[model samples]
Target: MSQNGPKMNEFEASTATEIRMDASRSTSVFLTIYSDFASAEKVWRRFEEYADCYAFQSFDFLDVWYRNIGHRSGVEMQLVVAWGAAAKPLMILPLGIETSKLGRKLVWLGNEVNDYNAPILAPNFGDCVAEGDFSRLWSDILDTLPAHDYVELMRQPKMVGHQINPFTELGLKLNASGTHMTQMSEDFDTYYDEKRTSKAKRQFRSRRKQLNEIGETKYVHPNKVEDIHASIDNLVALKSEALKAIGAPDFLAQPGYLDFYKELSAQSLNEGIGHVSHLEVGGEYAAGNWGLVFKGRFYYLLASYNGPKFGRYAPGLQALVELMRWASEKKATLFDFTIGDEGYKAEWCEIHEDLYDHIQARSLRGVVAQSLTNGFLLAKRTIKQNPKLWALFTKLRAKLANHRDFG
Candidate 1:
């Protein structure tokens, strides 16, 4: 980290919706696109050290994600670095190229696993690139890149570090779901009591009791590599079963995605970047979860349970309860439920953050692809927003999928 880089508060605050067209005299940034990860390693690490970014943009996390998941899926690095006068670093956008039959799409690294995708910006980012200039430079950057049919930027937060996320200026196509989170207290039990209303507390306790009734249940965060491996295996199996049962695409069963989770979990075990833990019933794994802790915030990214055996006990929900408690124990200030409208998330998250997606087509193929993608998303959103429709959808999906009932 630069010893003299601007602190977060020093950066001017801007919103993603509004463009800052101030032509005032200040520094400006130039763009340099790097296709390989290592060429910009030194500066990338330094900015990430003190950058106003969540852990999603962390160097190690994305690096591992790219090698395991992104590369395996045939995505190539197209990291964008913004440099200021004197060659000082301003920001680093870790992006990737994903080619498909429809078109070539540009996306952020850690696309599948990371909850949020953004640039790791130096505190002086806003000072260096006004919204107008930033947009112009972004065009030039794109022009320099190998032709991409379109750009698909998803799950972007409204704010980056201390300032408005520049991308928001692109305009917000509000995601159907928002990121959910809650504040933490010094102690788990105290936090549980203080943060939750009496009714909410009672409901959580009821869920916990159900698991206990199943037998000798406990929250287990493994320390040994072998135990972590065992936990990851159980997590994949449990998560895959639940996802498949819903008639959803079983992406976890894919080799790349599976290996990505295992590698990310094991690698983050000690570094505190990722957490892999499980809940046991009668000393057998019943629920498994994968969480990531970045800076001081905890992200509940992946979770699942033995739905057929433990779903009636609400194992999936209980696992979340345990993770929140665990996060409080570790002094995490915020528990992010990421981007989801799931009822469980609403029950606990006091902060709901609206996310955005930027989809732009550079060619005819991209136009057709973009329309189809948006159409599918619109249909999905319609079902999700209506309770009766969602229920009917789930029921029909399960029968068609031949899913085993948790009950």
Candidate 2:
């Protein structure tokens, strides 16, 4: 192992403990662990082409992540590209490595912005590859890891190929991550016709009519600079209102974070992966979501609102419906509602992906550290899950966060 590079752990192919027995025998694998995105261009682009098929997996997002977070955080990125003899890439996992108590640990990159993390594989691989491809891939990863004592897989959404069941079956402790999802059909009419109850359809129609009566309600899906900036403003405003409604600190209230989002918007737009969808009533913007559109899919990244004026019409829902319809028309395969399984998302989406917050601790010190971390998370989840305890827990967290000056 080079001084700056990760240590290598040699293991035999058949006897490797990490090798998943479920994958097919014919699948050949190639692995490249990167210290940074700039150095991992060849691998990043290879898998990203497959990732771009999903709207949430835009190139600009990966770029923003490289610029704002990873490089500054001293985090090492790992690029694993599993391919066949033809050298065509099959699965790509863009992972970040962090030093823990035991040794170095691996996780998905950009956890701060991206709601979900999963391997990027060509759909065609799904057909030709054997059943145990995932097992073989992990076996290779485990064998290659030298200095790492733990592998932490974070926020892998459900329904994606990397199912948690198999990992757990493989003896890795699994944590079920919290997230939300929404599904969109070919068009609004078709969606209503096939999925919605008559009452729900009528209610939405009534709301639309009411919104129209209030003033000219226009749906804006902006992909340019001027419109994107406007959408950012709305997103900030809505985020503030939403946070206040729940008596929580506004995330975008922090100048640094807001600036980061602004920079991301500019970069995403310039890179042709930016998306800003809004519902403007009369001359005022009611609500909007600023995310990214990769390939044809739409990622509902962020949003804001004009509380009192557009609250009745559910401007947020309107924007989502409009954007989803547009994406469908554009031949998008999915509309990601993004992280957190909120009530609204349950009503809108049919798909539910499971993501795990994983931590691996091999050494004694690592075990102690893992216990502390996992204990805190477990306590937090307990409080958050109970409605009666949530308010008190929130206040406590807020007070601690304020004292810590979390940014």
Candidate 3:
């Protein structure tokens, strides 16, 4: 039984039961599931009080994200909270239930959108776990894993925390590796000077020259509400056109997704937590980008523009450069080009944090399924690591799996 009164079904994990609580520790009882958004909010709000470094798990952030994406994603969430004196929240695991190929499973509380994933813990709580007392608390928490076939933690940023390591240590099969984008410093002049070689710098300057010589134009990041709306429309049109040309779907073009973003922008701006930037030439919206400004960090989330007209000058690149400069001027601590390992990120990235997809299985069938999945992942990794072998193996595999159903 949990030290806390009773387990909340919404946050219960299916794979594990009977958690062991630590009697020696000062931390109080644990709540298996948060009763409502308000409950989760209370815990998250305290997470900031415990640790400044873990500020991403704040109540305001959770509320905004849940408001925008929760309804459509089909993920049900719960908050795990541990309290101390006067119910000081010490640790939290944001969890959600999702239906995967294996069956119902526990997932990272945040979905694909949030860039970072880890348990929100108190400041200097690192030593608490290290002392081995919190291990019991952790085990108690794990015991609360509802009777699910698997647990999947998708897209973790960095491995410095106990969230990934603890699961693996507890006999769960761990698979840690994913793509990462750059977290460049906030000083634009210094960043560009340090990252751009003489040749690359010269290329950018030359492109600017070509753009100026070709047309009489100007670029601006609009602050007016009306101008921002117009810019968003232009960006969406360009993005839709590009996606259609490539035979892929545009995320912004999804019926409700665009409106969701617009709503998020309005809410974030109202709360002083979002920003939008645009590039205008000849008083027309050429390109636009928008993202969140949370806890002194800037996340570069989305961008779009009319294509090829400024190809020689790379207007998208130009927009990013100017926007980043603007961010630096605003004194943001970090600029996160999140969730991809594109070449552009390499140019200016000083920090490349690896993300991972973690999975834990229950039941005999789930075990076999996990084994097969890991085997396939290992093979994929092998091919990725060796290009020559990858070419040969991929061709054979593609030939074998070539069928209408593969798509």
Q: lDDT of each model, Cα atoms only?
A: 0.76, 0.62, 0.61
- Residues 321-369 of candidate 1 have per-residue lDDT tens digits of 7888888878898988887788867667788878778888889999998
Candidate 1 wrongly placed segments (more than 4 Å): 1-26, 197-215, 403-407
What stretches of model 2 exceed 4 Å from their correct place? Answer: 1-28, 50-59, 83-86, 99-104, 122-150, 158-183, 197-210, 244-250, 253-271, 384-407
lDDT of 3 by residue, 263-375 (tens): 55555446655566777665656678877776666788778776777655677887888888877777776777876555677777767666555666666766766677678
How far off is residue 331 in model 1, in Å? Answer: 1.9
Q: What tens-digit string does per-residue lDDT give for candidate 2 at 96-164?
A: 677744466666676556676666666665544455456655666766655565666655543443322
The stretch of ten residues in a row with the least summed lDDT in candidate 3 is 11-20
Q: Which ten residues in a row have the lowest lDDT in candidate 2?
A: 10-19
Candidate 1's TM-score: 0.87
lDDT, candidate 3, equals 0.61
- TM-scores for all candidates: the values are 0.87, 0.75, 0.78
Task: Go through the candidates in order and give the clash count of each.
Answer: 1, 20, 11
Candidate scoring better on TM-score of 2 and 3: 3
The residue ranges of model 3 lying beyond 4 angstroms of the native Cα positions read: 1-29, 49-58, 131-139, 159-187, 213-219, 224-226, 240-255, 372-407
